[model samples]
Target: MTMSDDIVRMARAWIGTPYQHQASVKGVACDCLGLIRGIWRERHGTEPETPPPYTADWGEGGGQEVLMTAALCHLMPIDRQTPMEPGEVLLFRMRPGAVAKHLGILSAAGQAPRFIHAYNAHGVIDSPLTTPWQSRIAARFHFP
Candidate 1:
């Protein structure tokens, strides 16, 4: 299998993880970024750096691109126009003009792309990449 396949498999393995802020143990608890961090540890050796304390609006309080900055530091940046593939990371803004604070892994690509993410109330789920979600995509990256 390809590296992307391994990443996808690893991400999907966390499908039922309960959403918990600042946690990354698979199947037990994790948030959107936590899910990505868990997969990162499985693929890469160790986390680049521990993240600073963050609220649900991790990027909003001070209008800092906290998540974006960290993503750039750790992930291989993908051009925005690049066609997404399974295992690529997606950074979402949550809403227009807001700091991009949400994240997910592309689980299925091509015509009907889908992503796996842990939402506060929903936990980890594979969600359709609909127009609304598409519109919120601020950036994309892949494992280094």
Candidate 2:
């Protein structure tokens, strides 16, 4: 299977993990970044860089795209204007003009693209890429 497929599969394996700030563990707990970190660990063996402790509002308060910047530093950037693909990483802004701080892994593509993410109070879930979610996508990427 392709690396992207592996990443998608790994992400799916973490479905139902409780959402926990700064934590990363499949079937246990993880935040949005933690979910991505866990997938990276399973696919790449280690994180490119250790992330320092960060607040939930790390980038929003400063109006900085901290998550997108980190993604560009590690993953390969893709056209945000194009349709998504399986295994692609998405950066979400949550609200207009806000820093893109949320992340989700695309698990399906084509007719109905689905993304897997750890949502607050809901834990990990794979949801349809509805228009509401699509409109908030700030960037797209793939693990190198």
TM-score of every model? 0.97, 0.94
Q: Write the per-residue lDDT of candidate 2 for residues 24-143, one digit (tens) a residue.
A: 988889999999999888878999998989888756778877788899899899986776779999999889998898999999988887999999899999999898998999889988
Query: Lowest-scoring 10 consecutive residues by lDDT in candidate 2?
Result: 57-66
Report lDDT per candidate. 0.92, 0.89
Clashing residue pairs, backbone N/CA/C < 3 A, model 2: none
What is the lDDT for 57 in model 1?
89
Candidate 1 has a TM-score of 0.97
